[model samples]
Target: MCHTGGCCILRRNRAGRRMTLSTQTTAPYPSLARACTVVLILFATAVLAYTDRQVLSLLVDPIRHDLHISDTQMSLLLGTAFAAIYGVAGVPLGFLADRTSRRNLIVAGVLIWSVGTLMCAVAPSFAMLFVGRVVVGLGEAVLSPAAISLISDTFEPKRRGLAVGTFFTGIAVGIGGSILIGGGVLDLVRDGLFAATPVAHWAQWRLVLLAVGLPSMLWALLLLVIKEPVRRHDQVFEENLPPAAGQNSLFPILRRMAPVFLVVAVASMVDNAVGAWAPSLLIRQFGMDPAKVGVELGLLLMLGYGGGMLAGGALADRFAIWRGRNGKIELCCLAVVATLPAAVMINSHSASGVMFAVPIYFALSAVVTASGLSAILDATPNRMRGRAMAISFFLNVAIGAGFGPTAVALAGDHVFGPGAGLGPAISFTVVVSYLLAALVLAAAIRTRRS
Candidate 1:
């Protein structure tokens, strides 16, 4: 029989002897106030990281024009150049998070990526901008593994879903804020708001980059105040026996979690594709002003994506109570299924139709994202979470960030014949990616049950 005070289970051996095995439990978690403060700080860091990373989405056209690059070339900047290094570096950084002070790692990451963002602001050519993005990727790579690991260690099992959800809301805010702020700044620049400043001579896009990148340095200093939590040894075992073969290694966990990784990959693929191109889609297809699109779209994303994240967290916690660990994965599957209609609607003929659809798509994707992350934390042991999350980040950046935008561009340039076909191309990417995610998530749930 199992007891509540300590995680103990009774098992019968082949010799007909019953044994009780107890997994190690740590001291009580940090106080709720402390945990909340940690989450708030981490959430702020996440916002800064993503804002620096994604602000480029709003600068695509001006950058393309200034650099004299094609959409395919620009897509390389948006996806491959950054993703390649980010994904590759994440493995080592993730392992480091497992062994080192995650707080210090994040502080360092913030400084490096902030410099990278500044580098992008002054980049004179496409090559330099690509290099800058690579630096940003390198720096930002430290975030997820470290942050998620920190969250898992600081909170108990049941409350992790909400904590993780709150942290990810930063992502929603960053993504939305990138466009909202970028658009507002761009509009202000065009209206001569910066005419008196030395930066008035710079192009609007460069100004936007400068505006977004500078604050991250100050944000890094704030992270210094976040005291690192004590590492906890939290692992659940189904039976009492010798440690399973390869238990200490990450490969076993990776192999078991393959489906979950795929779900995140495909979901990220569509999410990045939409984020990278939606502005262009609005401007080209609907004849909307870039600044106008940025404000409206940005507002919609913040509300939709942000709301979805909170809801997902709450639902994840609720599902965990109702359906055990698998509930998180079940939530992911449901979100993917619901995303299909939203995906189709993003390609609506009228601008109003597309506008209405945008929030729905973003909101649903955020749901999947929040629940999926919680599932990963739930499935991985505390000691292994940093590496596990690193692997997931690698897949997310490498496959989703590395390939998603480029795939859409290639399709638009080649299959869809450029200008006229971008809307359809985005629709195709979202629909196909989510379809695959749905199937994989369903299989994961079934496997869990078996």
Candidate 2:
């Protein structure tokens, strides 16, 4: 009897040991690999999108000069023409992202945007160019929602902020590179690189656009390398987590996220308004040549906004991690608090002061704050991420990127007019926008925390 009891205890111990080993051995799964691969693919997509958009800003004068359009018209091209279609497409694409093959959809979107970019070079009239811009915007509509949705699925709740931030690096580099490349190309054109080329008569600027726009086709191939992650359910926690909070229906989730959505929209609008109008204002006010403006302002934005983007993401991740120990909401609130002061500084007195403040503003601008987007996704279920992101994109892009530029240009046209001092007026408009963004962001923080 004693021997039998000892043998039984040993058998139970061995069984427990085997269970632990089995769990440990199976822990490393394909999801992690899929996450890393998809993030890189999404990053490339972002790079392409940003670069294409930036090219327009750099080539704005050339396009304007050649087409004989007004400042307001240029703004329309940047804002409404692009934003209208882009915003409209986001909803349908987002719905598709939630329901269908996100990977294939993104690949197709990339192809569409690439074609749009290339078309911008060949467009013969203002109307045709407008069509190309619209196409570009529409193609871009697919990127953020789909990529963010995938990232939300790939990473655990705690890691989503960093993932989102990392994904946004394409934004930083894309815009920064656009400014840099635009300036460099302008210099090349000014120096007569295109003088001997085939399209020597084709404005050097048009040539530049054609060159920058075509390379993104290569990115279409990159999509093939990405593997879609396994979709998660409300239940079936892999790490012994409880069944995650389930997704609400579309209407319910929209209502819950509305307040935050409003704030993001206002903030984005203000940010875009400032970004679009600034370079033009600088050229008009400072007496800086276009090529020179491209390089200097480009570097300023690069270091200030782009670097800030990188820093903001890291800060948000660290803050979220520290606060995630308590709650993600509260920590995100703290980030809003920290960014508020920077918004005020963006309107500081001196030009140098403003330049210094820009990176701070750009940093605080939801690039890092957007890391919380994943938290929103986590709060819901797998199926809702695309729609939620679509709503966010619609509000953010439609209001921010879409209207912001138009508003600024219109204000510059009406209030400042063609002959009036443009620089200070434009600055005033942008400053107001940044302040409003701060207020909206603060409100968003409160809403998120609550």
Candidate 3:
């Protein structure tokens, strides 16, 4: 039976040995229940942030009509404006997560993003709404780096990929949830679902943002229960470091990560581009409604990547063990080979053709994540893990999230301006991104520790 938030309790019987579970971090069968609880909290945070982030896209037509803005202006607000600042802010937050209490930072970020969502809901002008989006990005900057670091500390390498994969499920689910839920909300408000409230149809979108954005406040409570894992002590390996050297500095870690970072950034860019542009492409080209788009994408991701991520991690780890190779290397090579088809399928003309392509794309995308994340974490010392994630995130966001969609949007507007379909244009752009990703990831695979 599904509990609150759809949690299910699974029981195993082995020679009549009974296992009881609690949601705590302490070991010797440390609470799987507690681990799931923390994951649930992180999932909620991802859901809230991602949902509100994309709400602007769904509401773009309405916002443009109400505020009288141009597509170039909308592109600016969506891309460079938010991304520039987010890239700058993410590094410092990443450093802080490494040096300080990650859980506390995550809690604060949740609150910050929630308020930003509320601001978006009530914004009066395009500039004000842009400010809200920027705030949301800034706050969200804290999450992934910190969350990755925490997962690294809390779980061992063998199982860490699956853990990270599970966390990212929040992202897939959140995006899909936003599209599906936001569409329904918009329809209701537009159709006067709450006509007695005396609010404008556009203003009702704000209420939707506020309602979906606030649940993270309750999720913040998960931090209180998670026990902070001990930071790895250099003293434990005194010979590894010079006696006079400082412990917290990350330059050493960054130096080691240079090659790996290049791969992570490019691969992630391809992934984000496919995600950001797919909805708009389908809508503009295929004439699908927002709700249908959301449901289809959400179900695809849930079944494909959402579930595949967990399986990929397990399989990669096993493959690594079987071949006596690094899991990261195996995973990267697999992703490169697997994703090539998805890139081709995206450009397919028929709707049925593209529909069949979805699972391949998602599954390939899912494999890259868990392995890449584990590799990055393994490459850095505990003190530098947060910064490494931050740097990785900055590159991914700036290139992938920022430039990916911006490029697609610009292509759609200029190259495919009138009669040219969005599917061809987006497909062209996404394929280029994926090709670049495959090359970079191949480089990463070659460099993996033997």
Candidate 4:
């Protein structure tokens, strides 16, 4: 319900002699053209952040084989190493976003993660690689929370789903781009496209890491032009330009928003597990090459994830308008339920079956992400948006990224004994986690209406 707003913020001139009052008007609330530009930039940022994160997905086999590690160890590389810090660091960073310059934080984050990614490409040992992953996690921890907070302020509540969804298309793009771009590069190098050259010194995986990670360093610069948005909640800003509240002050607020936040967490947990294990599924059961699979599925993933997110956001907004405030939550609930069939499709043994089903899963999953973020923004106040989103991201990464990938790996390695265990593990996690998410989302709607 954050509205377009006006406020009087006091500033001290360089002379430091007098307090100056600056009028904040609602007149320039990111017009459609400007909003499109903002969303495009955010979408691009999402792509970069995720591309760096998922590059490791393609490198899992090499990293594990080179390090002489177990699947569990590989899972840690994918999950715990990154998620552990992202979850905890998000709160403080989110606090910073609310209180300081989100644009600067994003700039710092892009630089940090990009450097961590480069460090990952050069790590001489597994320990060094783990440290790099931790650094990447810390840097990435600031993005979506702050981005979501900023987006919440840019668009009115009713239009929020669309704006947020547009920004998130980056997630889908980054996910697909990582595989397409990374996998394509790896395939070319392995196929000896660079055979007689000095570039032959580095391994394909290292090249893949460097290729995706390095571009983000340049992308960070684009953030400098972005203006921090005027803060609002529904139709009003708190009378005085008060100091931004701390995370501890947000606990009571967070407690009230728990049902929806928890829903987001569980939903993320399920989706992340599916995305992490998908490449392996294609490679293992269907005898597909990692390089080949990446090219083939990359387009599908973009369509599924990006297209789905756009549809979900726009639809959820309409639903909210037609049915009232809680309508958007209902759409999210349906999205969770919709994933059940997608889960079954993705876990299928046939390559064609899984391929056909995976995109559907991506599209359906978009609803949860798009609607969930919009819902959180609607429920919380403006000053608390960043921290609230940080908490949501903490839950999101802690459960989704932290546990999902690892759980799938463990299920395959320990529970199902590594042969055909992965498919089942992914399917099981999807059904259980997504079902729980659906129920929680529904309950949250009821809680709101209550």
**TM-score per candidate, chains pooled:** 0.90, 0.80, 0.80, 0.86
Indicate which candidate wins on TM-score: 1
TM-score: the better of candidates 2 and 4: 4
The residue-by-residue lDDT of candidate 1 on 235-280, one tens digit each, is 5433432344123656656777688887887777788898889988
Which regions of candidate 2 are displaced past 4 Å? 1-37, 153-160, 188-197, 234-245, 317-354, 366-368, 371-375, 416-420, 434-450
Best-fitting candidate, scored by lDDT: 1
lDDT values, one for every candidate: 0.83, 0.65, 0.64, 0.76
Query: What does the lDDT come to for candidate 4?
Result: 0.76
Candidate achieving higher TM-score, 1 or 3: 1
Q: Over the stretch 1-450, how does candidate 2's per-residue lDDT look in tens digits?
A: 111111111111211221110111112335666777777778767866877776677667778888899777888877778888888999888988876777777888888887887788888888888898888888889888788777766776446667777776766655555676778777876778768778778877787776666667777787877666555432111122222323235665466555456655765676676567656655655555777767776776666666666665566456545655214344444445555566556444555655566556666564534544534553454466777788788877888778877877776668777666445454556556545645665666566546
Residue 149 Cα positional deviation in candidate 1, in Å, after optimal superposition: 1.4
Q: Candidate 3 lDDT, tens digit per residue, 1-450?
A: 221222323433222322221121223323566666666777767776677666666655556677788666676666665577679999999988877887888888877777777787788888997888788788889998888777766664445556777777776566556666666666666576656664444465566676556665566676567666554321111123332222445666555555556656655566555665566666666777755666576556556765656666676666655643355656665676677767777766766666567656877766776566556654455446677788988987787667766776677778777467556666667566666766765665566542
Per-residue error (Å), model 3, residue 409: 1.8
Pairs that clash in candidate 1:
none
Q: Give the TM-score of candidate 4.
A: 0.86
Each prediction's total of clashing residue pairs, residues at least 3 apart in sequence or on different chains, is 0, 3, 1, 4
**Cα-based lDDT at residue 166, candidate 2:** 72
Candidate 2 residue pairs in backbone clash? 268-400, 269-400, 304-359
